[model samples]
Target: MLPSIIIVNYKSSRLILDCLHSIYRQGQEEFEVIVVDNSDDEEGRKAISGSYPVVKWIRMEYNAGFARANNAGIRAATGDIILLLNPDTLVEDNAIAECAARLRSSEYVAAGVQLLNTDRSPQITGNYFMTGGLNHLMALPAVGRLIRWLGYRLKVKKTNVASAEGLVEVDWINGAFLMVKRTAIDKAGLLDEDFFLYAEEIEWCSRLRRIGKLCVYGDLHTLHLQGESANDAFGSSGKGYYNLSDRKGYQIMLSGLVRIRKQFGAGWFIFHLAAYLFTVPVYLLVTIIRTLFLQPGRKREWANWWGFSVNVLRICGFVPVILSKKPHFYKVL
Candidate 1:
């Protein structure tokens, strides 16, 4: 086989079906499809598996989060090349083939495809590793906007994928459409299961970097219905739910803490604590101003404020009873 594509479906049966449809439309049979149903949706699984008999469906006992679920698929996959694709994605013709080709041709351990939103707008498909300085700047509202504006103007921005050509090296590619060589997996080891959802790929990329380079292929693109599962879980509580998904926000923060603690150690955790403390007042002020002014996206601003507050508490060793009792937010039903 050319490669084994693994997709973890979390209660997004309809989306996964659409994804599989796209794959079949591509008419590439040199690979296999493995679907890990973390949601354990029996009806959805049966329907999809019956319709797409070739798809390998693994019914999970419960939600195991992104990392472990992917690891399960990775273990079951027999291909020398492993692809971790999101269920909420539509693959373009030859996109996976091109990525697999790039991985085989180059010394790179992993390769990812350009991903776009439904409107065909380019998404942030890849990113540089988060540094303390960059994280601090992004945490401050004023500086963050300025930094983003500068990045947009610089033309070297990560999201400027529409004009990007060929395969470019990157610190890490988003897990939505990541492809990795089997040798790289053997060398770098499986993804850290500590990260339930968000930041898992970033941590895994760090390990891959130790073994080989990671690149983002710009020749092909995939349509990604971003956050479909997360939105279904924690959305529509109020106005402009599209601006922010609380489920994703919480999982990102929790997984981010896990990533920082593991990757950078206690020193960086203290650094993050100091940085969060320094920016809390500014974030609070921004939240109040945005709310009182009835900003167009006040909901998202408030969501960011809430996320920062929760993360600060976590940093201070004060875990809420609910979260303390349940460590992985992504697995919560």
Candidate 2:
């Protein structure tokens, strides 16, 4: 078999079924759709089977976040290449064909794809190279505001980057509409299950970079429904863990990839931890005041700050899996 389409479905059973049906109806190639539903109730599975029996559905009794679910789908996949798509994305007719052609034509590429928004414009999926340093440096609170302004406002998009028109090696690709070579996954290992929500792709892409450059073909395009994976509006509430996600993610990266003992020289990463100890509380106060006053709700900023602080307290002796260097990672359209 060629590359199989692997998608993890959560509560949006309606959207999930719609996404799969679109592939079945419009996918212009030979492929199978594997839906790994993290919904414990089997709600998504039962719904898909009743309507779209042709699609294969895998049910996990608990919500396994993003990385673990993809790992499950990859393990069950029979295709040489695997397309990890989000349940809220829409596949264009040539999406699969374009991805296949790009990967098949180039031996250097491991996996990637073009992503678009509902308006049919390219979506920004970040860079092929994933990093905490770049995210931290560019998105460094005050100065990062400017970088985010440009990146989120004006930057390269998924459609323009992942086309077949030319071939360029990239650092990281977005997991939203990512296409991966099965061999690449074999080489890189499964998505790091530690990332309960985000940064798993960056971690995987980091491994892929070790193998070869990741290819992004702009010709193939898919529509990504942004809010599907996150809350309706990030506002102030979401900014914190979403913020801490990177911090914690970086710490995980550091510990997993580069031993803290190596980078900080035997318990040196602790200085940063001691600093975070104070900052985490301060961050909660600021985040809560900002979000609660400005854009309130179930915002998780304080929660994330608290969570990240706990990790900083724990990663006292482990190495970080990710480096703090900033590279020109790609942007999704």
User: What is residue 23's positional error in candidate 1, in angstroms?
Assistant: 0.7
Q: Which ten residues in a row have the lowest lDDT in candidate 2?
A: 324-333
What RMSD, rounded to one decimal, does every model reach?
4.4, 7.7
Model 2 agreement with the true structure over 86-192: per-residue lDDT tens digits: 88888786677667766866685465556776777666653633222233334222334555677677663432243333444567777787887777777778876
In angstroms, the error of model 1 at 151 is 8.1
